[model samples]
Target chain A: MSGLEGLYQQIILDHSKARHGDGPLEHAAAEHHEYNPTCGDELTMRIRLDDAGERIEELAWQGDGCSISMASASALVDLMAGRTLEEAGERIDAFRAMLRSQGAGEPDEELLEDAIAFHGVSKYVMRVKCAMLSWVALEACLTEARATRG
Target chain B: MEGMSSDTLGARRVADLRLDFPVFRDAGEHAPAYLDSAATSQRPARVLDAEREYLEHHLAPVHRGASAAVGRSTTLFEDARATVARFVGAGERELVWAENATDALNIVALGMADASAGLGGAEASRFALHPGDELVVVEAEHHANLIPWQRLAARTGAVLRPVRVDARGLWGPAELAAVLSPRTRVVAFAEVSNVTGFLAPVAELVALVRERSPEALVVLDACQSVPHRPSDLAASGVDFAAFSGHKMLGPNGIGGLYGRAELLDALPPARTGGSTITRVTLEHAEFLPAPHRFEAGTQPVSQVVALAEAARYLDELGMAEVARHESALAARMAEAVAELPGVRLIGPPPGEERAGLVSVVVDDVHAHDVGQYLDEAGVVVRVGHHCAQPLHRALGVTATTRASAHVYTTEDEVDRFIDALGGVRRFFGVAGAGEQTGVVA
Candidate 1:
């Protein structure tokens, strides 16, 4: 595939068009806003923790951005919906590492699922922020949720 | 071709002119259509050679030692100042070397701030701002022109009155006149808006400011205009103007700050150090005249020399011819982009006059995506708020994709841009019938 094809995979395009968990969630425990100043891409990520505050019960977002950012948000919802907060944090780290590796780090499909499509995004330094915007917002939301719980 | 008949001077053909720019020559057939000249222009071989020749042969401290090398360096530096000042239609003493256009503007604003704090004494009192005085600025101004005034206002208890732009991200003399008051201390605006490509009627606005607030100093952000169009700072009647070299086929790290001679002499120098002062005591020091007073530290002598070469290059090409070519390109780009469905041109409508740039918003596609698509097609452009966030916000879009031109830009490149943009909606499946499998509703 050409570099542009790799960056804009069909799966990523599909996910962007049919965004999952793409609205304001009611009774959210924590919400965080992330902005990419360079291109003006912005997102508001919301999450609800379970009663035990260990697992993510719900995850949703509302934002305007490119296909990479919107698709990353949708894929994040699919990957972290029912995962434990600890597992989600680990996944965020792995995804960030893969994106920053400049097409070197091999992403485990089992861990990343549809988000492995973003492996090609790692090669383009400018697009890494777009792919990571939602994940960063999710991390911040989780941090806020944990702080509130404490 | 409207102005083409009047002046046959300069390199009339862009194909022939492209040879002078080494980047285009080196890139050969695969060169991306460089449509981002509004951000920074490509340097010509003459400009590069001028800088290299100075640094390789005669590198010395300027305006310092009485050595032969120092004298030669100072002569070259001051000669460059003359060339650039003449290009902008100013006296050599009125132009001061600065880091860039932003730094040049900061010098003016900071100098005023210092004056407000009683720095330059009685002569500087003209610049001092009172508590309720107003500093008028256009809402569509780039952050470089807007933020300094904001900081100056914050420091001097001055009120910032923004002349709001319309939905198209443009403000006229009427908007400026409405915001002007008797208490207005400074009215800062751009000669040509970086985002909207709107060429301001500077003389008209200056006249309005003079009529409404006679004491107010008019500052022109000439970063866009001085590089692309014909400019005469003295004739425009602005008290001060700033422009950078990099955007005019010159080296980075050098720019010009043009001030009326008397005003420059009266305004206090914000930066004070080695070369600017005449005599220093333990407690106080007296500064030199206008240009020297503003120039504090060691200068970018090599860059200044190259900037002069760039000025000569443009002069050989004749600014009128350059402006005519770029304006044609802009109209072509705007008209073509307007024809494309779902694309909204941001500046003056087709058939109206604007600068040699076109900014557009593609429905349902972010400018980042548009830029990536254009990049893949080998059509370079500028995307994002372009450091004019308030203007973008006022236009009800976060960002817009801008395609700008210089003497080297071609019709084929503009066509490529239009072609690439036409496919953006379909590629993203936002327009026309396409695969709609995953849509939630």
Candidate 2:
């Protein structure tokens, strides 16, 4: 009923149209790749880190997908970049909860903007799988990045 | 809506009758108008009640047990066999129960495999296929018919030649007979095409096969046809016929193969286990006769009982009346769809030749989108290629929407479908009836 405006919003569409959240960061950093076969969404995500890999210097991602997933990746890249591991983990948990709508507490106010666009998907059960496939793939990529350091 | 006294066939066809099934009656919001009859048919109250009656009162193991339950069950089981055989115009002795229609068809295939493999003992000559021999089937065959013969040909080094349908979903007597020569050892086909509802002239084709190649064995996939029409398998000259209970208002996991007793005896069982064997030695096992030999495992008893009831329900309404009635309904449905702007009848035109259903492609709309939109309107039709990929490829379309009718189907339902179909293009913002929709979701 609301047309595509509410679903797309300004920030998400800009990110999708520009593909700004793309490519690996230059210099030493943690990197990951994601794949969602259901809707043909694929992303190679990269995050630059300080010497010890405890703090994020830059975060970027490249992928092709529907408007929602690509926008979420771009927003995540922008919001989580320059944040420490502890803060990034909290943010990730909050994003996952918002998508699930079942976690113990709400995510903080700042990083919740892009994630709100997807709440409409929960009503359509079939679309939920399509929307979550990318996020799950991103989590897998992040887990792989953390494992590589050990 | 049912019984002989009823003015019309109503929604009594095998697949359409499923809506009367209590299970389907539970579609609270969006009922699935199941058009996938070739896959299975839903059971109506008559068939279900028949099953319940048998289970509640006539419960027992048939053929061997001596208790009152056993006697009553055997009567019910034997009575089912007679009813199914009679429905297809075969003698009761000639009909043999298998697991399902696929199993029924496989019994023929494996037996042919055996004869081709020289496993039929003294009677092996009746079925043996040598190198350079031909096994003729049609391109419209479901994988159930195709794969088995393909495997059989592979095993025996025989050629599998198909009497293929053209772009319009039709294969006639002259075209089919053209492929039959001295080399053709067998001719197999469906009495009706599951995808297109293209009715084949079984009697004429089988007669040609007999004339052209006297030794050619004929097998019929009655899975689609039997549920919709009255089939006289023996009279049609096919040596064997297969039909499933699920497709004919019975339970799933059960079916039958009607074979002339002499022919059945010649065919060795494909599966061997407890019941089918007479005596077992360390060296070899002597198997029981046909039907039981082919059964091999504990048969689907409850389903078989249910199938027997389905046959009786069909009998209560005369088969000839059933056929004629559904023919009119199918024709009406097809004609209504054809009249819709830009609706392309994928199969034969109405009255050209058909069983009791139609498949069509609408211009400018993807079938999936069409199906989704129709679901909103509470009209359920089968979307996508109806499993005959080769046939669909031949017809030059990726998918088509099929709406089939049975006895329970009303003329009003047909009109509603046609009316809603006209709106499908406009609702989806599709341009025209002849224009194509590319990149379907």
Candidate 3:
């Protein structure tokens, strides 16, 4: 597949259209709002941590953005819904590293799952920001959620 | 270049002028069909070389020293100012140097803020606004024009009255008439809508402002119109106007603020320091008049020189021809793209007299995705709200993709853009690619 096809995989398009874990997390520990002024892509994410504050018990978000950003946000919730904060951080780092790699980094497909489709997006210097917008929000909200517990 | 229209004026001139720009020359196969000139124009060889020559030879501070080098540099700089002044139809003293068009508008707004606060004494009262007064601006204005007026209104106790735009993102003289009143202190607007390419009826608006609110000051954000057409700011009867150099084949970081001599002299200087003072004391200092007072600190001398060179180049080509070339190109582009399935043209309908720009919203495809698709097809365009969020909200689109043209634009480049835009919906799988939904003009 070409880079454009790889970037817009069937899974990404489906996730973008019918996003999972989207729209308002109730009794949430933390929430964050992020906007990309360049293209006006916006995302508001809410997190509900478990009683132990070790795992993200629930992750919900709402946003209006391009297919890349929407899909990335959807795939993020899918990857980290029940994972520990440390594991989520690792995944975020790996995703960021792959995006920064300029289409060169071999991301762990087992960890990234649907997000590995964005490896083609990494090739585009501009679209990397689109793919990473929600992940950045998640990182910030996660940090805030951890602080709220502490 | 099949389907290229032979009817457009200056089609041959565009072909000839294409060679002056270096970007088309260097990038052969990978050359982007540039259609984003309204955002920022690409400089020609003459403009670039002028700046290089100035930097290489005459690099000295203007208007400061007693040395011959300083005198020579000051002459070059002032000469540039004069050339630019003539280009925009203002007197030498009427024009002030600014960082860019945004800075120029800010100079006026901030200066007015100072005036409202009793800064320039009694002479500045002409600009002072009170709680009951209203600052008028149109919804379709670029943020460069709108935000400054908004801040001005906030700083003073004046109310902001926006003249509403239609669903097409256009406002007419009737809209302005509806908003005008005796309490209107300032009327600020763009001579051309950067996003929608609506050519504002300047003379009619000025006349209406004069008739209804005689005391109201008129400020024009001339960033779009000044570059593409022949403009006489003095004749237009606006109190102040701002436009950038880079949009007119000139160097960046240089722009002009044209204010009527009476208003400019009375208006308080927003930025102050060296080169602006007539007499200095520790507590109180007397300021120089108009352009000198506004131009604080060491100026962009090389940029000024290049900008003047750019103005001269444009003058040689004739602004009328440039305007005709770009308008025809935009009209052609509008007609071509408006026919595409699910594609919506944002400005005036095809064949309307617009100011060389075309903005569009594709159904079910975000503007970013459209821009990406165009980029992949080697067709560059501007994407986003284009710094006019309120207008975008009014138009019911979060963002739009704009394709604009300059003097150097060719029919082939516009064709490439139209063809690329035609394929966007199909590539994105937006549904009903071939099936027309009556979008054709």
User: Judged by TM-score, which candidate is best?
Assistant: 1
For model 1, state the Cα shift of residue B105 in Å. 0.7
Candidate 1 per-residue lDDT, tens place, B98-123, comes to: 99999999999999999999999999
Q: Interface RMSD (Å), each candidate?
A: 1.7, 7.5, 1.9
Misplaced by over 4 Å in model 2 are A1-150, B1-7, B10-39, B433-441
Error of 1 at B207 (Å): 0.8
Which portion of correct inter-chain contacts appears in model 3? 0.55
TM-score of 2: 0.74
* lDDT-superior candidate, 1 or 2: 1
Lowest lDDT 10-mer window, candidate 1 chain B?
B432-441
State the lDDT at B416 in candidate 3.
Answer: 83
Per-residue lDDT for B254-362 in model 2, tens only?
8889887788877887777777778899988877776667767666667777787778777676666766766676677677777777678877786565776778887
* Complex DockQ per candidate: 0.69, 0.07, 0.61
